[model samples]
Target: MPVANRIPILCLGLLLATTSCERPAPPTTAEASDSYNLAAYIEQQQERLQAEKPMVLKSVTTEEKPTETIQTAEIDWEDELSVFAETDLNRPALQEYYTREERVLPDGNIVLEYNRVEDAEPLVHYLRLEMTPDRVLRQLNALIQDQNILFYSRRNIQLTADPSSGNISGYRVQGVQKLVLSDSLHYQIDANL
Candidate 1:
């Protein structure tokens, strides 16, 4: 075929190839899965707090000889709650890595626990969500750890929310970090939203 004639054919073939395949559907906000929709939940909270822009009383304590600092100001909820977001286990890749357990307390609270499968070393080692009987989330807790030859850090993160209003009331992050050649550092952050 002549180049002039082949151009149209090539264009047609390219168009057909491009249109033949369909894009995978994006996961929905209420994506149905065995695990809780943690990412979506965090996103919802972030959106709510970002719009509200409420003032927060935050306290930070650090070092072996603890030095405490306190401040009250409006904060970026998305950034402040990002550590909790990092612990989200709703990704498709993680669906099979963690096993979830559920139990209802005699006090009428529901608890959901997620733990890694044996031999799995996901960054968020443990996650627990406690909710009211009506499904209002009361609290969330997680343990996040990262370690390598050069550095190691472990943190316990907790978020407490109001049962009736579902508003985050407070959160805490406590942890220690150690570098290969430096002394360990201990730190804690408590924020009242």
Candidate 2:
């Protein structure tokens, strides 16, 4: 039990303990092969995705064909005149006023031959009545009031007058007026009166 001898034994025990402990072995090539397989699988997926990519799209072209033109023959003047004459004669006012046979010419003209006293009177009255600009405008306004017509234009009155004379000689008016019956349907009146 000498102190120097005990010290030598303790040093020998520490040397043996440190030298006996062994380090763990490195992974085998099989583990490395597994990691390599995973990388290969990812590369394969990427290659598949690239292969399935869509191609560049292109626009389609269509063939053009020449269009055909159609020509119609002109109608006869006598026929046109007759149609207009018939239309005028059939009007409610004219029918009520005239008790005569109306004839139509080829040039879209009407010739009225009165057969009764009433018819003659109306014809004379129409011929004698003056259709001045002011009179015409007054008549138009009366008609609008009588018919209960409403104008759709933003302005109350859509008319133009002569600057120098201060008279409505010639003008054009266009607007929508409400009808009596249904709310949906409206009358579109456009005229130069």
Candidate 3:
């Protein structure tokens, strides 16, 4: 053939090769069996890995134990005066002045001792309360003693705490306290606490 005819034939062959370039067909049975074996081996390995791994804490606890429960109180009822009396449990919040102690007497009664600092003044408050371990209020002896720095006229105090609630049910405090700043003096203060 002529060179012009050969160039046209070469262009047509190049165009066909570019448009319909194809690879050899893969072997069907061998390839499919190999892929299926690999997938099954991977799934088996995953199952073994899951079986070897330890169970989570939440799952183990849920299976073996109940959900949750609150325990009973361990301390004596007298010792829980701060909680029952509606007082602050954190001692540092009260400038570390308040203290509580519990003791068992020979008569099977509990003695609750409290030493609290007067927030309003510089005086100290001392209290000794006697009660039963099962929340029975017997008696309370309180002393709101005076400090020489300020003029305080105190007569008498009568207080009664509720057995169940551990709070003051009937209270009578009679005293006249004057702050250091002003000249105005406060008179008798008798109120139910």
Taking all chains together, each candidate's TM-score versus the true structure is 0.79, 0.16, 0.33
RMSD score of candidate 2 (Å): 45.9
lDDT by residue for model 1 over 1-193, one digit each (tens)?
7899999999999999988775544445443344456677789989998887777878888875655656655677788889999988766666567887889999999898989899888899999999988778899999999999999999999999999987789999999999999999889999886
Ranking by lDDT: 1, 3, 2
Q: Candidate 2 — which pairs collide? A: 77-106, 78-106, 81-108
- Name the candidate that leads on TM-score: 1
Cα deviation in Å at residue 168, candidate 2? Answer: 0.8
Q: Ten-residue segment with the worst summed lDDT in candidate 2?
A: 137-146
Candidate 3 Cα deviation (angstroms), residue 84: 12
The digit string of per-residue lDDT tens for model 3 on 1-193 reads 8998899899999999987766434335442222112123224433543444322111111223444322322323232222123222222333356566778899887776667745644233665667767636655555564656655543234445556654443433444455566453333222222
Task: Please provide the root mean square deviation of candidate 1 (C-alpha atoms, Å).
Answer: 5.4
Candidate lDDT scores, in order, read 0.84, 0.30, 0.44
The segments of candidate 3 whose C-alpha lies over 4 angstroms from its true place after superposition are: 1-90, 116-124, 144-156, 162-169, 179-193
Question: Which model scores highest in lDDT?
Answer: 1
What TM-score does structure 2 among the candidates reach? 0.16
Deviation (Å) of 24 in candidate 2: 99
**Candidate 2 lDDT tens digits, 35-62:** 2121232244235434543221222121
Off by over 4 Å in 1: 1-34
The candidates, ranked best first by TM-score, are 1, 3, 2
